[model samples]
Target: MTSIIQTQELSYEAAIKMCVAVTQHAHQLGVSVGVVVVTPAGVELASVRMNNAPLHALSIARKKAYTAASFKIPSFNWQERLKHKPDTMSALLREENFTYLGGGIPIIVEGKLFGSIGVSGATEAQDIECAEHAITEQLNSL
Candidate 1:
């Protein structure tokens, strides 16, 4: 067994950029939102709740990021994945900070999970759109 492992970490600067990107996209959609970035271990790096975004959005955004990072999948995927796994769903639903919302995605770096990003406060579709667009447009240099 190895005593050490190598990992790619998500920087605060990068996380901040992602939040800014999310904010810009939200502006384009004429909506307010909360955005969060978290490490693969589900440690929060940065977060933002835009003016007029519901207070609830901040917590939801955090959970969305945690869910994506913990599962190594988009948080929205849980919806379909849990449909036939009532037992699994029951257990998972009780896990702290786990969510099935459609606005979380893992931040993939060179085929590895560097971290995750989550967006909330808009419709699920809009939130997902912002998350994906931020990764494609702003995270290219990561």
Candidate 2:
């Protein structure tokens, strides 16, 4: 018997939908945020910044999403890893588009890594909450 591995695909529209859902929830909470959705290859699919969000937040959001998509780990864990290894952390910073922030998280579905979504410009907790809501509820629900 032979087994096949079916690759999970996340269309750009789906990624955008996830981002919108997360942003809407964040808005309801009175938290302005920037969101970035990236493919598994770390390419940005869609990005949005809430009204009055910081200009730097867009860059930070993209970096966080890229970091998560590239590393296949949440940004918070990346921060902890850096905390344990300052030298390594410094080295990682030298790489382009690497951010150890709370808003970056990978979107995993059916135990397969799909892509990533990042949220910023809000409190770290709120950012993570938005990301989680999108990944766990909206994205995964599809």
- Which candidate has the highest TM-score of all? 1
Could you tell me the lDDT of residue 112 within candidate 1?
A: 92
TM-score of each: 0.95, 0.90
lDDT of 2 at 60: 92
User: What would the per-residue lDDT of candidate 1 be over residues 36-88, giving only the tens digit for each residue?
Assistant: 99999999999999999999998999999999998899999999999999999
Check candidate 1 and list the clashing pairs: none
lDDT of 2 by residue, 14-119 (tens): 8888779878999898988899999888888888888888888889989889998888899888877778798999999998899888989998876777889999
Q: Give the Cα error of residue 114 in candidate 2, in Å.
A: 0.7
RMSD values for the candidates in order, in angstroms, are 1.1, 2.9
| lDDT of candidates 1 onward, in order | 0.93, 0.85
The candidate 2 region of ten consecutive residues with least summed lDDT is 1-10
Model 1 ranges off by over 4 Å: none
Whole-model lDDT, candidate 2?
0.85
